[model samples]
Target: MSGSTHTVTNQPPPLVGYDVFAADRVLTEGLERHLDPGPLAETRAELTVLGRAAGSAQAREWGRLANVQPPGLRTHDPSGHRIDEVDFHPAWHRLVGKAVSAGLTAAWARPAGHLRRAAAFLVWSQVEAGHLCPVSMTHAAVPALRADPGLAALWEPRLTSTVYDFGLRPASQKAGVLLGTAMTEKQGGSDVHALTTRAEALAEDGTYTLTGHKWFCSAPMSDGFLVLAQADAGPTCFLVPRVHEDGRRNPFAIQRLKDTLGNRSNASGEVEFDGTWARRVGDEGRGVRTLAGTVAAARLDCVLGSAALMRQAVAQAVHHCTYREAFGARLVDQPLMRTVLADLAVESEAATVLALRLAAACDGAADGDERERAFLRLAVPAAKYWVTKRCTPLVAEALECLGGNGYVEESVLPRLLREAPLNSLWAGPGNVQALDVLRAVQREPGAFDAFLLEVGKARGADHRLDAAVRGLLGELGDLDAVEARARRLVERIALVLQGSLLVRYAPAEVADAFCAARLGGDGGAAFGTLPHTLGLAGIVERARPVE
Candidate 1:
């Protein structure tokens, strides 16, 4: 409403049709109500950045392309999976354009870590989970690019001003570039070491010849790909152009499109690269580390996006509960229903904040050292592990609140339920994250210990939350003797509180406005629980004599 709306006349051939703006508006309004002015401003700023980068002509084109299908209704009936092909829209490319520009700019320009955190929150909060989760991984590249200012010049202009409407254009000066990496064969998935993709280096042309059959190429039909291959040295990232700037097809061919569950808005296909031309991303031998780092940031994005969809579901549930009747009373008036709603709100708040905290830590740090990387390495998996794990059950709970109405396509709950599955498994699985946490504790005892000490100090000030901290510590044992287990417990609790900090900052009027609710009641007690809880405890545990 702040800006004047412009009328656009589309001149493109038609595909599927839809009520495009309805769901978007529903989400927008709900978010406005739940979020505070600060986050709201942040979200608006992000929207502005996204809007500006994707020119109006491209925006309308995407809207028309996206409007062609009923994304909310598409599914594979036989296996109860949503057919993935139904999800690809030219409009999504435009969204990516905006995301890359805005996200990268925020990373580069924002001096305060809080602004970067807010940008990350806004980007993922707007996401409705699907196959897009993988495509969503593209945004992860922003933070790394920001960390290395030298890469900023290379990434900024292309990310902020260019739109890849047709896919990857190797020669285009656009800001958003889709890097494909779907090279998993039948036997190789999470185990990339078992991959069969080969990229033979040709020093004469400064290009490599790539040959491979890849499964799960998320954007199989588009622009460029970050092809992963095995060399004599090790696994590595190769930039392969799929389309030329003149719009000629690159050597990468689409073999078959994979039918998928949810996120039908993006493509997940089988691809073949026959002597595909490519350039190295980092070092030849450092590909696996680069790949893992890329994947780690992506895991954080999964958590953030899932949390957003969860919020959308919560909004729908809350709206329905307040208006719909059950036995002559509003569903929200039912005590049990209210309890379920309350718990969902609490969890959503927590997940969102932890995500922002991680973003802040990663973006704020000037040095891209092991310590900075450690925050995201640990936080991303934990987030992906927890948020998605919570989403399915949360959707189910919301569905129960809706009764039979929830199962209907006319209602968004069914779409949400169908879409929720992808996040839990994406980025990395839950067990992978748990192991990452174990590794992080073992790798950086000093920083990890420092982080824990902060949490402990915060907890010491709050008797209620301290009890929870103590319970975890007691279960894990003293930090000095049982450092690894103790670190895990402290870290998880700190993460929970970190998320609450965002909720506290955002407009939770019920908690923020009322003195009794904020100061004298449970909200008051909860508000005082997290600042340095882990920090203090970490110090105490470390200071104790080593047994």
Candidate 2:
């Protein structure tokens, strides 16, 4: 692998979190809904290209896992077993590839599906391994790992599946595994300080030898890992390969895999790493920082996943409404059905728009500096909390729309409903996420305020976007202080997206539609009313730009 650098400039802004107006703009721009016609169409075509080879089988395997009793109830001795020896059924692999492919294809055709395939694909990928492992950590550490010029050669061919040792590069075909870091330990679930994993530097080898037991590794069967261990300086991240290139070797012994309620496919495993060889990623003692970055990305991924799942539920409900007859009329024909569908539509739209806005924010990043990181940090918990928490009720409501069929296995609603809760639980449950949001604000009091100020300034400068942003900022200033202000931050997310979409992409008509929808015009409820009101009042008062 040769080292070649390409720089991206004029990127989109970092996404803060979810909002209704933001979603409207995306749909108007056709990002959510494609303009192309044909079997695969445009969005579908793009999704297909991005689809993992292991999608279909993964879904079926996931369904099976969902149907089975959780691993928590199953009798298994982790002390006697190793994660790798557990073979992934061959049929499961085939099913995964097909499902992922089909899911991706369907996502493009239906804006409502969006990231559903990716969510299910990821779910099954974890299940394929039969245990939960911290798989998202790799995404954060890979940049540093790949940056090591010395390791590039070894890393290149391993990244993608397309690079057939025969000839093609992995990029030519999509091939990547989830990577993660287990920050929590037996003592605490969210407190990193309680982490007991220790990394001792080996004087002779110039490498750290890691020894510790991790409480929860969420994808125990993942291809690679990012392990956090306490070094002399502090906690640090070490890139540890779980499976070797030859596809043999599992040094970490499994203590046990947690039987989770929703994310059952991947067993959440307790792992004991005994003298695992680990290369330091990023600086030592900055594991927290590295972990933070990783968490940010993972949070975004979670938000995307949540939004996609919500979209899936809503789409299924909408489909059912169109076909399932009620009182001699289509379910959609009923006023109540319309209300339910509208609520789902609006909420789903809000979640998706905020997700896309986050993508846009990262895109606009000149470099992944403190500001970008800050945006992600604040946004992660908010997005995850909002989307996942919303996912359960939204899905349930969607199921309600389906009535009896919603409860049945044959109906996808039941599966979706079951899977939805995991979105909240898997990523530091909603309450944990809320606490993360508060912590982020405390750490960087100006982070969110800066974002709103930037949007406000941009709007003031652009005549076309002025009214919308001004209206948003005014609402921000009117919120109650402290907790109430914090609440408003949620709504401001929608407003920020509104400004972002108007400036970055969407047309005037679409932007207007978004603002109207969010502001509660045209029979729409206030999209980000509570949060926007709360966060804006709290932060805006502390640091208001001189007019």
Candidate 3:
């Protein structure tokens, strides 16, 4: 009985067996605010189911196993037959299959599809992020393929199908399909115009043969790839299937799988395409324009993915603090710890609200609202720039709240921290997003007007936000050194937009703290620097995951 040395006392229980979607007040609130009444009920019911499943111990184990047992590259069969396949753990398939069946990739077909899928994505991604790569790519590819109706008709239904059909086969043979992208070359990066990959016309049926090496081919195990290559006219988009309609393997080789810092459950490969068969998606020389929808949709996913990580990090931090004790007091009850948790909660809330707002804009655009389309031209990049940038630091700070325990892989905070920067770098780097915002403001008059109208609605509702908006306007007015000052200007634009949303929808305590800390600059550089009189405890409690 005296051998009790190993008994733990102050440790918190594992944060599982709770509704991930329903527990997130901010995410649920965003759903209510964005979705119509009829759809809101059904969406909530569906998401609640996913949330519960995501929160289960079984699902958590699946996520852990998927990451630990990262996918492997199987370049050949036992007889040395060329079979470029990436071998994933069964857990990986389960996570991805659940996502696919939950309608994550079927968003393009439903009413308020973007909002519904964004909410589902944010919640399920909390379970595992890696599998969502194909999920997101399949979702984004819908619009890009639509540029060619024949291609859309051929692939759209499979890509959006709820059945998670996994394997290399002809698109015609699959009930569901995942799409990957091989656009960035070794030298070009985001500058697709600099790509040297050449595509030669093969037949009059819009078929081409591509020969190039893609530096980063995301979700390599996908059924097909939306590749960008130089055609006779110029750079154009093409769809390259993994196999021919007759079950013959395409000339696609997965050279090597990227050893990424995190999201190891997913396979990103350096692929080679020598005489790769492809069908052109749109007019040659207008590849960038044709794939603009894909880029934008992916950018939005960057924000949503980052928000999911941030939210999960904060939830873990707050949940830890609620139980772990030091010096005869729970960490959540300590003044400074509560302040830190509140600061993190505020950040998570702002990100959730802003991300859903962007999703709502997409929904509007789908409903034929040109104004929302214009608004997205500016808002998506700006939010993508700032929110994803904040995710890394916020997650790192959240991990710190657990002290040494958070540093270990068992806590999941380390995983969250590692996954944090992936979103920022995925669609394009921060600089690209900032410059995109600049381009939108300069070229699209309606975009800037739409942005201003968005922020202007909350004018005088919160003085600090108003001042920040004015400051943003003045910064926009001055074009001197604008290119050099793009990051600064974009940060202003993003913060003002977040402030506007918080002022309108967030609780008084949350909005006030956000305006004071982010807009009015009444706080210092650290998370615990918010003014002492704010409702820090209440904010922390709000973010606590219900179990």
Per-candidate clash tally: 40, 62, 0
**lDDT of each prediction vs. the true structure?**
0.53, 0.52, 0.93
Models ranked on TM-score:
3, 1, 2
Q: Write the per-residue lDDT of candidate 1 for residues 333-433, one digit (tens) a residue.
A: 66556645555554555555555556656654544545555555555565677677777877777777667877875455776787777776665566666
Pairs with backbone N, CA or C atoms under 3 Å apart (clashes), candidate 3: none
On the 0 to 100 scale, the lDDT of residue 137 in model 2 is 37
TM-score of 3: 0.99
Off by over 4 Å in 2: 1-44, 48-84, 89-92, 95-141, 144-153, 160-178, 204-206, 243-250, 366-377, 431-446, 453-547
lDDT of 3 by residue, 1-547 (tens): 6666687678899999999999999999998898879999999999999999999999999999999999999999999999999989999999999999999999898899999999999999999898899999999999999999988999999988999989888889889999999998999899988989999998577999999899999999999999999997889999999989999999999999999998888999999999989999999989999999999999999999999999999999999999999999999999999999999999999999999999999999999999899999999999999999999999999999999999999999988888898999988999999999999999999999999999988989999998898788888899999999999999999999999999999999999999999999988887878988999888988999974
lDDT of 1: 0.53
Which structure is stronger by lDDT: 1 or 3? Answer: 3
lDDT of 3 at 35: 80
Over 4 Å off, model 1 = 1-127, 131-135, 142-156, 160-168, 173-176, 244-248, 366-374, 471-547
Q: Where is model 1 poorest over a 10-residue stretch in terms of lDDT? A: 538-547
**Which candidate should be chosen as best, given TM-score against the real structure?**
3
